[model samples]
Target: MNEKLRVLVSVDLDGAKARVKTQGHVTLQSIQGLYDVMKRADSLVPGLALELDMTLAEVEPQALEELRGCARSHHLPLQVDPLQRDYRFSILAPTLVALPVAAPMLAAA
Candidate 1:
């Protein structure tokens, strides 16, 4: 059977803060979700650093390593959060990082 992991990603181009939160087991098979998230983040804002939040996940050592690798390769400054418990939700759909959306203009409006 296929296992899914909950992955929440947010990128703030203006603030330079990109976050990815994952929950549940992060095995080799399920890690694809993380990769896909990273890829989407890259396209939305290339060279943007990351602020990872994996506290929701009961990740393995391999998962941690893989996370680090992804950050390193993308030159993202990763910061793993320490909270939550576990979960399982996967989405293969396209990711859109519309961070801040136009903060200044919106604020003015």
Candidate 2:
């Protein structure tokens, strides 16, 4: 069967409640919500190729790791697409999150 991979881009949080200066003010809780939504989609359609944008490139190593763990636990291949031209990689997210550290990415919600 030819299955299409489902792709979700980190295009600024949708329906944000707070009146922030810009859409960059995305919070962890909000991200978690996105995870929740993605999880639901997975449940409904097993084996769906799920993908997400790498919000924090090289800076948020910890956050990348945590997301990796979450992806591994769910058996989903987590990825981080670098926005900068300097780096171009498709590193698995599990390895990053499994480290003895937490790279929490938080902002005003």
Candidate 3:
């Protein structure tokens, strides 16, 4: 499993609304991609919101705070769920998002 920061941008049909989806370790040092996405979204979309799902991620509180900081710096709306467990990370989304955060559910621990 690779531990790297990844970000995905989703835009509404009118292109006026956008949000971000992220995965990976999201350390303090690796947020360039996230920043880029937020900046692009802000420039291209009027209101940029973030949808953060970090339950499967082994994220420390500081890491979460760093992510929030990125959002704040960009003046984007941020939403997070440290306890969220409902998601199916599709391989088509991105390599980073699909890099196997959790063990196979059917496998024995």
Best by lDDT: 1
Q: Given candidate 1, what's the lDDT at residue 16?
A: 54
TM-scores vs. true structure, each candidate: 0.57, 0.36, 0.49
TM-score, structure 3 vs. true: 0.49
lDDT of 3 by residue, 3-101 (tens): 765666686636355556666666544554555565565555434343544444444445456655544454422333232222211112232222224
lDDT of 1 by residue, 3-94 (tens): 45787887788975577776666665666666667656655665555555665565555556665654444432233222221212222212
Which residue pairs show backbone clashes in model 2? 62-103, 63-103, 65-96, 65-97, 68-93
**What is the Cα root-mean-square deviation between model 3 and the actual structure?**
11.5
Each prediction's whole-model lDDT (CA): 0.52, 0.35, 0.48
The lDDT, on a scale of 0 to 1, for candidate 2 is: 0.35
Please state every model's RMSD to the true fold in angstroms: 17.8, 16.1, 11.5
lDDT: worst 10-residue window of model 3: 84-93
What is the full ranking by lDDT, best candidate first? 1, 3, 2
Find the 10 residues in a row with the least total lDDT in model 2.
16-25
Ranking by TM-score: 1, 3, 2
Highest TM-score: which candidate? 1
